[model samples]
Target: MTEPTSANADREVLQMIPKPATAPEIGPWLWAMEETRRGLLRTVRGLEQDALDWRGASGEDNSIGSLLYHIALVELSWLYEDMLLVEPPADIVALLPHPSRAPQGGLQHVESETLAQHLERLEKARADFMRHLTPMTEADWHTFREPPDTDYAVTPAWAVFHLVEHEAGHLFQIREILRRWRAQERAAP
Candidate 1:
């Protein structure tokens, strides 16, 4: 656990605000992450399969589904493996299912689950993440968490931001897909 360096001094001003004893002062960081999760849920809820599944018609990287799964999987993995690295929390692994084991051909062969099921699991995982992060001591912010068997460089803090970005980008793509889909739907003979 690392202490706040001079680099973060400007950002730590709000850390002075009182937080509930239970939640601690993980404040702006946690709030930002929660809002991001909420935004993702809004995009994902009640989405049609075509809207969710459509790869870019013109051929582009990152289908919406792929992005959503990637975001959710990485966070889930962080909460499970990364958090346990130094002290090794056995109880935590028993808390939730490990993320779909990072797929077969690395990032390409990710798992397939219904949109509803994925959202449900992700929502649960989000709650679990809050439980882990909300009480995180200031020291927890300094250290980096790198998962074993993976080359990714993500701290728990960065993991939250990464999830937000992935979800938001896919949400944008999803909307674009929906726009074109609606046009096609109405244009049909």
Candidate 2:
């Protein structure tokens, strides 16, 4: 049998073991987030610029580009606004140029950005989130942070859980969009 290269060997493993995280308490949550991100990245790999921006003819729905931007922005928002209880520092602010919401209460439309730019933004948000939580104690992980304007409070643990769920949902959406994009292309005269 032929030997597989290191890169191919890495792809051969299809298991769900939780890798070690920054802290023992957060190991599983971080694992979930990391796995979800891997799936998302795989889904969007090699997407052309137009596929990133495509809105599927109706032109009002969220595109893959907007979803990618929103996912990154939500992680940063939770890290700063919810957990740290402050505005995103200047460095984080520079990573996301658009406001979180559009005028019509949807994700802001992100266009013209290459997939590489979107991935970079996501990496920044994920890195910042992991770094900020590395030193978190068990008390902080379970303690709730109540924002003044929000209807409900959230703990670090629950917030990280929600991020995993959120990203998974968006990943499903991205896959469906990709499926439709290909179907449309096939149907074109």
Candidate 3:
């Protein structure tokens, strides 16, 4: 038998939907969410506070800090309100006291927040989500919530998928914002 080359040994295998050893039922969902979180973090890593707070030329209000905060807030909201059907715990509430969007329908200001602080909030929210999700059985993953006075019902599986999509969409926005900010800086005299 031929020996495996070092290049082959060092090659990274990408799992599109990885299964968690402990909880195979929702493992794929968890893996997708983690991938989204990691992508967002990697995109923002090493960014200074000014970069985090930069806005586009049109005065668009979704700063990297606000986007980061919004991502965490929306994930926590979906996990607690939609999946678990419970109020968010006190710690999470404290971490995100304001609404994700202002009355004007723009992202709320996450004022003076450092990249470390935004990352911490994101990590905390994900940890809480995983803690609650880890124990769910296959049945729980398919369980649906039909809130009062609402025509729609949602399942935990769908909620998790939504979280992944939500993060990805915002991460795209963040990349564009970073690109614009860098371009503007380079154009400056």
Candidate 4:
């Protein structure tokens, strides 16, 4: 092979540069998110309505539906708000309504939504996320500044890891809810 001339080397270097880099990437973080998505589907598939409706007799947090909504909220919000950090911003809240604050009443507090609705919404959010990520410019990821969280200081890269981990954490919660509900069913006469 012949050695490259200076002109050729300069051109190659120029080609390597991209528009921007908006995030840091760790491959395991992405794998973890995909795995969580699978687990969430497994937990809910073929289950009856009551199973979806069930909130643990002891838990105080939101139901599976609320958790799903939270995941969607973060995904789309990051896409428009932080990742792009646009002005006259994309109003994701209007597109995806957030749950209103309400008084708690045992399981009734979390029993606020059906399983199918939650899953369908999450599915769409996942699709949108994949679309946005696929063609992300290298410049977009590298140029990305860290977004501020009141209690947390996070770089664009960390945000991806955090979001992925957050979904996984919630998926595990769903797993527990399913486990608890199944136990209740088995105990029933």
**TM-scores of all candidate predictions against the true structure:** 0.62, 0.89, 0.90, 0.66
lDDT comparing candidate 2 with the true structure: 0.89
lDDT of 1 at 69: 67
Superpose all Cα atoms of candidate 3 onto the true structure and report the RMSD in Å to 1 decimal.
Answer: 2.8
Query: Model 2: runs farther than 4 Å from truth?
Result: 1-13
Report the CA-based lDDT of candidate 1 relative to the real structure. Answer: 0.60
CA-only RMSD, every prediction: 9.3, 4.4, 2.8, 11.0
Q: What TM-score number comes out for model 2?
A: 0.89
Candidate 4 has a TM-score of 0.66
- Give the clash count for model 3: 0
Clashing pairs in 1: none
Candidate 1, 1-189: lDDT as tens digits: 455666765674433333332435456656666666666777667876665665545644344565566666666666667764543245434433434434544333223456876676566666767777777766675468777788765666666566667666666775676677678667879
Note the Cα lDDT for every prediction shown: 0.60, 0.89, 0.85, 0.61
Expressed as tens digits, the lDDT of each residue in 95-161 for candidate 4 is 4654444554322243555666677767777666665654555455445554555343334456667
Which model scores highest in lDDT? 2
Scanning candidate 2 in windows of ten residues, the lowest lDDT window is 1-10
As a whole number from 0 to 100, the lDDT of residue 140 in candidate 1 is 74
Clashing pairs in 2: none
What would the per-residue lDDT of candidate 3 be over residues 1-189, giving only the tens digit for each residue? 355456777777665666463558688789888988889989999999888887777766688889999999999888887877778778989989778778888889786888888899999998998888878888878878875556789998898888899999999999999999999989989
Candidates ranked, most accurate by lDDT first: 2, 3, 4, 1
